[model samples]
Target: MKVSMGVHQLKMEGPYLTALRESNDIREDAAALQARMEEDGYIFIRGFHDRNQVQQARSEILNQLHQSGRLAPDADPEAGLVGPDNKSAFLGGTNTDKPAFLELVNSPRVMNFFTNYLGGAAATYDYKWLRAIATGGSTDAHYDIVYMGRGTPNLYTLWTPVGDTPIEMGTLAILLGSHRWEHVRSTYGQMDVDRDRTEGSFSRDPLELIEKYGGRWATSDFEAGDAIFFGMFTMHSSTVNVTNRIRISCDTRYQLASEPVDGRWIGKKPRAHETALEAPLKTMAEAKKEWGLA
Candidate 1:
């Protein structure tokens, strides 16, 4: 199967890309789950959350978009049809404080899973990365550590699709086994998105990494309540949104409560990468050249 990722067309069955392996079978067994994560760099769970709750959260977000004139007036709010404005929205900061959004992220199901997975009490970052991606919008390839590696190396990211997300709608994709690429980790992962004042993404072209290094890109059609969890070093990105409807999803971080938290993502008001915006950013090409990755 051929799919679009960023600006490139990729063959899903060949050496380039493939479907993600689902780990729902071992979800209840922490030891098995941990072993799978350690080997594959991620775990994809089917129906990891309550479907109704996820749909409700999606409805609330769509209604907000409709009220702001971002959704087509003729369409039902739940449809999430983009209006003429067609602007993408990132609700990572204060906007995440909305009641429905908070409930979706802090649901007992997600909390309990993390607590068991981490082998103790688990706490999530207060700052959530909620996005409403419009047509043509997509994220580039990058490691989570570059953006949030200030403290615990054990921190993990849980990505939840707010609704049914087919390939055309642009969903998250992981570069299989990329977490074990020690060379890339020591060089690119060591750099900070905020401190380095760089573009953040390693590459807009997914094929670039595949050609340089060697790993299959894995993704799947995700339904509401489906979730994927990966550690800080996992390399991942999203496919392009080819559809008219918005692609809604959220990225939340988790770690053991006893571990030191990244100060940028916690507290009543997180000072998340605010200082980086003040300076002129360096292009990935420039940054990669400095890191000897080019």
Candidate 2:
């Protein structure tokens, strides 16, 4: 199967990415789920959430976007259409702040999934992030740690599709066994987005990733309730959306409540943060002191 990714075409067979293994027994065998996550770097939970709930949240989000004049007036709310005047880059961070979106991310079903899966209570970062990936806009390859490494290193990201997402809609994909790449992890994974002037990505090109990293990229046609959970060090990215309709999804991070939390995303409102490249700048004197150059 062929899929579009940021205007690039990727065949699903061969070096691209094969189907990922599903954890059918995740509910019954927590150890098995952990083992799979440890080895494969991710776990794909099919229909783990209620489809109806996901749709309701999706409707709420689309309605808000439509009201904000971000979505196309003529398009169906469910379609999440954006007008031609809108760039395919349309997405705002505020959607996650909506009550509807909050309910979706903080739903009992999701909390239970983490609590059971982690064998303990899980506290999520209050910032529930939602994205409407317009056509031509896709996430670049990057590990999650660099963006939020200030908190516990054990943090896990839970990603859920707001609506039924087809391959053409550009679902998220994981790089097979990326967490095990000690060379990459020790180097790139150690660089925090807030401290390093980096994009936090290994690469944006899937072909280059496979050629250099020796791992196939894997994704699926996701149903509304389907979710994927991966650790902080795992490498992942999104496929491109070829369709005119915007694809919607939300992600939240969970860690043991006992662990230290990153304060930025957990408050009533996150402080305006510098860009990844801007936050790492240091003056020569400060840098020299840190390096003991003086």
Candidate 3:
């Protein structure tokens, strides 16, 4: 199959792109699930949640986005048509907590799955991400850790399909077994999204990554109940939305409750990267007067 990934139009018929291994049965076997997570760096579960319930949440979010003037008025809310010239609509850092969205993340199915899979209490970051990706655009390749590894490295991200997200609707793809790649982890994995050069993604071109490094990119057609879970360092990116409808999805982090979570992502109004930067820092000279530490 020919695919559009980043700047390249590459043929996927070769050994380059593969479908993720199925682990929905891991829902019943927690130990097996964690083992899979450790082995593959990701587990894509098809229909892990109830589709009807997921659709309800999808409707609520699309309704809100449409009300916010992000969706096309003439298109059905479920259709996810973007406003004229929207090009892209992202609410990753600035999206606030809402009753519908809050309910979606806090769904019993989600909590139950991780609570058991993690073998302990599970808590998610309050800063949930929602993206209304339009046609011709896709997420740049990056590891989750670069953005949120300040706390427990054990944290995992659950990428949920807000609605029925087919491949044409632009679902995500993971670079096969990236977490265990010592070089990528020791180098790119150690990089921070907030610090250093600050561009979190490793590369936008999938072919270039394979040519320089070496790992296949894997993805699948996603349904509303489908969920993909991966560790903080797992490298993943989205396929372009070839269809006209907006590709709606939400991704949030999960970890054992006892584990420390980054302070910026845990509150009602997440401060995110500018949490401290928005405020001017006190210079050493000024600090001498206040702290007597000069």
Candidate 4:
């Protein structure tokens, strides 16, 4: 099934369209920037680092992993494989004074883009869960907030690819404008799974909806420094890393300064919708009150 989008729905508007203009420097105006980003599910920040700078950072992360002896024996010696272990993935900082991983997260270019979206008071930083995937490692469709404690998920995630992410190389893909809060809450409410879903095992069975109606799907070929910014509610997943090469990237989360306290995840019991849908199982009188379908 193919999820299709009408012309207007796929059209870019507000800050998202303006930010892409060559004359505008998004970092200069935080308000307009955030407005645009929020209008769309994502914004791509171009040229955060020079090719050489990215190479240097990549080198440092690889070297650090080697010195720590965390490199898997079966892993390619030159590629600096990050094992499936989350702990070992973070060990990149152990070798160099400021490894590539640290630099990527701490770059002013990155901060400027996020500050506009998350605001000044919002919490911002990288976490240790950024691990390396084995040959076939892949993630199911889910929100990022599930890993972090629940609060109004005002945050967005920035995925920085350290190496070339060709289409076949397994780059990230998103449902594009699927960041609707109403739909999110409604969808989650329909799921039997709740906040307990884990990153490795979380998935929704409505895989067909992605291609239904007029929906838009997009993917990018990321260079070393290009970052893909996406909201937590954005339904996204990726293909398995089938290439012989190892993919290197960093995933960072951002949120509003005053996020609300809600333990619900992307997939929760859809009580409200279920109640309405199950009306057929009830008597006519009860169904009338339940769904107002009388």
lDDT tens digits, residue span 108-210, model 1: 9899999999999999998899999999999999999988989899999999999999988998999987999888899889988778787778888888887
Worst ten-residue run, lDDT, model 1?
93-102
Candidate 3 accuracy as lDDT: 0.78
- Looking at model 2, report the run of 10 residues with the lowest lDDT sum: 285-294
- Candidate 3 wrong stretches, greater than 4 Å: 93-97, 275-294
Best by lDDT: 1
Local accuracy of candidate 4 as per-residue lDDT tens digits, 25-68: 66467676667666766666666555667777677766656566
Task: Give the root-mean-square deviation of each candidate in angstroms.
Answer: 1.3, 4.7, 7.2, 10.3
| TM-scores, all models, native as reference | 0.97, 0.89, 0.88, 0.62
Clashes of each: 0, 1, 0, 14
Instruction: Tell me the lDDT of model 3 at 109.
Output: 79
RMSD of 1: 1.3
Q: Order of candidates by TM-score, top first? A: 1, 2, 3, 4
Q: What stretches of model 2 exceed 4 Å from their correct place?
A: 88-97, 275-294
CA displacement after TM-score superposition, residue 140 of candidate 1 (Å): 0.2
Off by over 4 Å in 1: 94-97
Per-residue lDDT tens digits of candidate 2, residues 1-294? Answer: 787764477777756777777886665687888888899999898887888888888888788777776678887777788766665433434445466667777888888878877889988887666787776778888888877888799899998888889878888999897899887777777776566655555566777766766888889999988989899888899888878787888778898888888777777677524564454554433432443332
